[model samples]
Target: MSQNDNNTDQKKSESHALVKSDENGHALTVKGKGRLLALTDSILKSAIASRKANQLAVDDSWMQEIWNWADSFTISEKKIPRNRQMLLGLTELDISGNLLEILPESIGNLTNLTELNLQQNMLSELPESIGNLTNLTKLNLQNNRLSELPESIGNLTNLTELSLRDNRLSELPESIGNLTNLTELSLRDNRLSELPESIGNLTNLTSLDIFGVRLSELPESIGNLTNLTELNLDYNNLSELPESIGQLNNLTRLDLSRNELSKLPESIGNLTNLIELDLSSNNNLSELPESIGNLTNLIVLDLSSNNKLSELPESIGNLTNLTELNLYNNRLNELPESISNLTNLIKLSLHGNKLSKLPENIGHLTNLTELDLWSHNLSELPESIGSLTNLTELNLGYNGLSELPESIGNLTNLTVLDLSNNELSKLPESIGNLTNLDSLSLHGNNLSELPESIGNLTNLIELFLSRNELSKLPESIGNLTNLIELFLSSNKLSELPESIGQLKNLTRLDLRNTMVRELPTSINQNRVKVIL
Candidate 1:
């Protein structure tokens, strides 16, 4: 018999196959059908059609509107033949959110398709035929079970955006290099361990998000993607990067936080366009590359939470444009004098460090607004600190400071001041000059009493004088009408000041551990809420 006759005979045989289950009972069996079993084919297509229609019916009007916009559709159970190219060519196809375990070989026919979103599906693999959709620009396969891609995928030369986030992909095919037109790619929250070496072919890519991946290193070819503007590798296991990364000259934002990186390549200085670089919470980092000084355009740099870092390079002074610099939670004992060169710095956080003293030239940072030196071993501030007239928030809490310079009064713009947990016995009477101050904390100190000038800070809002040896508050305390939260716990005070009742904005008062045995009549009437 001829080939045509043989195919016809086979189709006839499959049409007569015995029924297995008719859960929905919408299909009928035809006699003499072969491999292209008529009953099986119709049953599968109707099942997929029913599923789509059901989903669309239950969806809100917005989704129904989208369904209407999708010009193409799919029906389950039908084997899309490899040669049936004309059967495709639909603009949008929704074969996603289904129980599909395999892709059909006939999907290559959809050359005009613009979007293919198959999210929340059980698809484990894609057919090489999909490469035929050269006109496809957006492909979203998030929340899928796919572990690999076909080499033919590279043929989708027109694809601009691809999202495979939250998938089980372990690796990518070299054929991926063919997607040179791609601009954005997301592999976030996936199990990917490494990226394909051919990924460098995507030179036009602008954004790449691979957060929470298991990537340990990137291929040197990645540096070829100089057009990338944003690169996110947060929460990864990367230990180092290729020196070629410095070639990403156009990159503006780079996030390498929460990684295991111990060092950065000196080549990183080549990224002159970098505006923000986050290397926070990398506990193993011991030092920064001196080449970092080359990033003169950097606006923000975070090296916080690297407890093993011992020092910063003097080259840091080269970041003259730096606005925010964080070195918190480190073991740094001293800063280089070159640090005084960051004259434009606004917020400098060196909190929870082991610093003994600051550079004498620190006063050069006249533009600083917040200076956090909390938990350091600092015993004194340079008299030059009086030059930081722009400073508003100053944190010297948890330090070994025994005395403050009278020059502290020079900070006329000061608002929040934290001197808690220190060995201070007296504050300079000149402290009263900080009239703009709103928050003042002197808790856990050796103070016996506040200077009467404390009453001069009429704008004070939160006052924490707890855990001290104070015997009494001045009658002038009532002048602070803006006082809100007052903590007087763990003190030696014996009586409440009648003036305390004048703080109408007060919200909470703590008298715990104090010698006060009786409350004022007004306080006893629940007029002022106090914790004793």
Candidate 2:
């Protein structure tokens, strides 16, 4: 018989045998928990030795020590688990945070145990006999020094959730494939560079996490996990995915962020059930598959930090159900007119891109409530944008816009508007129509004056107009009775506007390094902190 055959049979024998000791100085076999506890070590060892070929049990002393430990089981809450067999039939044990270094091999005596938690330990290895716990349904060995797993781990075929997160495991044993019933497995923050092809055998797996590994590629066999609903492979060195990945039709959420992937297989579009897909920080990704539009069920798509991407496919417009799309930190120079098809979009992030213009019909997304276009090269906004009556926040900072369309004041629902760091030299008197505006930022521009209409923002709470060419603040600024913080430093101001004292809610006022020569007497009665 092969050595492998011997080991297999050995495991089989131990599971069925009931041990005991006889009077002949030789151990005997008897059933039941019959206080076999009193059996002498030499007697038990002798009996174990007489057994035929299979190496059934370990040293008698070792077995006794395990039985003793089992009898010692008690919860640290200074209480025992409230089970009828609290002392004899422990089905669950959590000795986590105990700082144990070496787990005894005799732990396998727990044949009836269903759960074992040894998380947060300094243990560097698990005893080979650990596999004898055939009934274990959950095991948490996270945050340990386990550099390797025992091959017998395959014996715990009933484990549904196994977490080895934050461990030192460099690779999983090929025998892990025997756990066909596992549903969730976490190997995050490990040194694993590759997974065994046998992992594909986990057809029942629903979630698999391998984030923070050094894996550069996925095994092609990974596609066999058709029942998976969520998969996280973020922060790995993966530069490509297997074409077979499209087989995960049940997958609803997938994260492949922070990898080296330059392109994705077109098969990715086959995940019609995918609702959320994050491909952020893949620096080499230059474009997405045109088939990406096939994800009509998608609600969120994040492609941020892929700076090499210069454009998106027109087919992207097909994600009509998408509520959020993040394209931050890319090199996109133009937007597809098809974006108008995403009328359900609520939040759109396009910051740090090279976009010179926006889709003229972007207002078609009237459902949008937040729009982030900061740090782009946009010189102007299309007048059609005002059609987004639901917009509450608009960010156009660090752009080269010379002016805003007068239609901007039409977004009466806007609460936060940022137009700082632009080339604007003037504001249309119609700007004051934003009566619902709560905060406005227009600093670092060429504006020499404010339209008296600025007072129309009756709800304005915070206002920033620093570092501009402003020679004076519009008296309407004092009408912002809800103001709390006002920054107006480094401007060409010559004197304080008496209306400023009318700001009853203003708490902080900055006026350093400006041309202001004097203060209005009302400023004293208003108790405003003056920074001359």
lDDT top scorer: 2
Models, CA RMSD each: 12.6, 12.0
What's the TM-score of every candidate structure? 0.80, 0.86
Give the per-residue lDDT digits (tens) of candidate 2, residues 433-479.
88898889999999998998998888999999998998877778778
Give the poorly placed runs of model 2, Cα more than 4 Å off.
1-85, 525-527
Q: Which candidate is the best by TM-score?
A: 2
lDDT of 1: 0.86
lDDT of 1 by residue, 1-532 (tens): 9999999988776656554556856553434535337667877899999998886555434333333323223443232212223234357665667655665554554567888878887778888888888889999988888888888888889999999888888888888888999999998988888898899999999998989989988899989998999999999999999999999999999999999999999999999999999999898999988999999999999999987899989899999999999999988999989989899999999999899998889999999999999999999999999899999999999998889999999999999999999999999998999999999999999999888899999999999999989999988888888988889999999998877888878878899988888866544335557888
